[model samples]
Target: MKIAIVVKEHIETKGGLERYAVTLSRGLTARGHEVHVYANRWDVDESLIFHYVPCVKWLNLLKVITFPANARKHLAKSSFDLVYSLTPLYPVDIYRVGEGIHADVLRARFPNPLKRFLKRLTPKHRSILAIEKRLFTKGNYRAIITNSKLVKERLNQVYDVPFQDIEVIYNGYDDKLFNTNTRAYRGNLRDTYGIGDKEKVLLFASNDFKRKGLVYLLEAIAFLNRRDIRVRLMVVGKGKTAQYKRIAERLGILSQVIFAGAVTDIERY
Candidate 1:
């Protein structure tokens, strides 16, 4: 069978979603299915065919709006047994909801009612919401796949997608890189960071610190400090640390938090 995967970017070391796309393509190819990846940017992988979907990069809203339109045009020119999309593209065979509902994300990111309303009015959010509504309400895909039940429930409640149409498949890790063998590096990693044996270490890893609630984690750490608990937070991800550093300082727990910017070998930490 010939399969096409549509995503904005396909880089294994970039992030979880990108890595998933790469892994899926490789797995399908290894199983004797011809796999083609459609993306605006991607690292060269010899095993799979690549099709570039051009999109504007100057503006965020334009980037969101153009990708699906461009990707659909490219997809229409090809014949594939399955069209599996990681990003929002209409009328695919399968649509994987890697990122949760945009509406729910906005609600969480902007707790203030007025701020949330203002954010919803933005062109990017509006365009995303419109696409999501069309995709879910119109049954654009044969089936919807969500990484978590929370997202599946939200899809049902917000877009009225039938429960039977959504399947929950949890995210998987690369066993080759993440298995027990990686545990051998744990002691060295702790030593490199000067983590004492007695100190409890908490790891918070995410590319988007704001959305993932790094501030909340820092607050919890500060609270623990006040109770005379010795804890060290090792943050491992690619996100701006200046604002969060100021936050830690304000909470008087700057010394306890270690911001380890993005590293490829995350499993060792």
Candidate 2:
């Protein structure tokens, strides 16, 4: 079967979603499917075909609106058995909701009603919501794929999508690289960071620090410290460290937090 995978960017080493796109393309290709990826930008891979989806890179709103619009035009020129999209787009056979509902994210990020309202009024947010609404309500997809049950529930709550239409397929990892054998590096890693054997180390890894609740984690760590508990936070991701560093300093846990930015071998943590 010929398949088309749609995403904004397809860099394998970037975030989880990007990596998932790469892995899915490879897996499909390995199974004898003719896999083609449509993206604004992508790393070159010899195994699959690539189609450049032109996107306006100047503003967030333009970037959001143009990519899908242009992708649709490019995709229309080709015929494929399946169109699986990781991004929120229309006319897809399968839409994978890697990022949870945008409304739910706003609610979580900005709990105050006024703040949420203000955010919703922003051009990017408004565009995203509009696209998402059309996708879910108009049945743009034959089925929806979510990585978590939480996402599935939120999609149902926010968009009235039927529960049966959303399938929860959890993200997978390569067992050979991620299994217990990787624990052998634990001691060396701790030594490299000068973490004491008695100290408890909390690992937080994500490219999206704000959405992943790094601030909350730091606050929790500070609270632990106040109670005479010795804990170290090892943040391994590509997020900006300055703001989080200031936050840690304000919380008085600066010395306890270690920022190890963007590691490829995450299993070592």
Candidate 3:
């Protein structure tokens, strides 16, 4: 069967939804489907024959609502049997990978003002969410894929959609890269950063710190330090770096915190 996957870049790596898009496309291709990915013009994957979407973030939020005009046009132009949409905050059909729907996990990790507001207002906050909800629940999909059971259950409850619609598929870590044999790679990474073997390494990885409870983690680390746990935090990610640095400075733990920005390599983790 021919397949079309719609996705967008959420980060260089680590966005579960983005990973799902790439993963699903590759998997389907392996099974002999003619797969095509539809994404923002900025996204590049020559190997996968990625089609650039007409709409992108720079134009404005208004474009977000109306500019998918091109995507709709593109879909009508295709005769693919299946379309799997890896949600980049837009709606698509047949297969989807819903993310972070566990209320407990959301509460623990993303207790931020904006996230809180979005959760409460949901479809009311943006027309996109409502569009997504309507398409997902009402679409003619042979199967839907979700990353987690919690998310699958939440999708059913939220939209009152059939529970059988979603199939659970997980995001994978590269076992080859993360194996014990990767010590050489890890050592090289550590040496590049001049990180000492004796320093208590508090490795925090996230694209957004505020949403991931970086402040709470820092505070908890400070509390741990009073008990003589001299820790050094390596924050590997993209957004709000300056805000986190300021918070560290205010806590007088600036020396202990190292904002590593974004780095590539499985060993770096």
Q: Quote each prediction's TM-score.
A: 0.96, 0.95, 0.80
Off by over 4 Å in 3: 10-16, 42-47, 66-68, 88-92, 101-124, 140-142
Candidate 2 residue 58 C-alpha distance from true site, Å = 2.0
Which has the better lDDT: candidate 1, or candidate 2?
2
**Which regions in candidate 2 have their CA more than 4 angstroms from the true location?**
none
lDDT of candidate 1 at residue 109, scale 0 to 100: 84
Deviation in Å, model 1, residue 164 alpha carbon: 0.4
Q: Native-vs-model 3 lDDT?
A: 0.66
Residue-level lDDT of model 1, residues 1-269, one tens digit each, is: 99999999999878889889999999999999999999988999899999989999999999989999999999999899999999988989899999799988887789899999999999999999999888886558899999999999999999888999999999987788878898799788889988887788999988889889999999999898889887999999999899999999999999999999998878887
Model 1 gets an lDDT of: 0.91
| Candidates, ranked, lDDT | 2, 1, 3
Highest lDDT among the candidates is held by which one? Answer: 2
- Candidate 1 worst ten-residue window by lDDT: 132-141
Worst 10 residues of 2 by lDDT: 132-141
Residue 26 shift from truth in candidate 3, angstroms = 2.8
The TM-score of predicted model 3 comes to 0.80
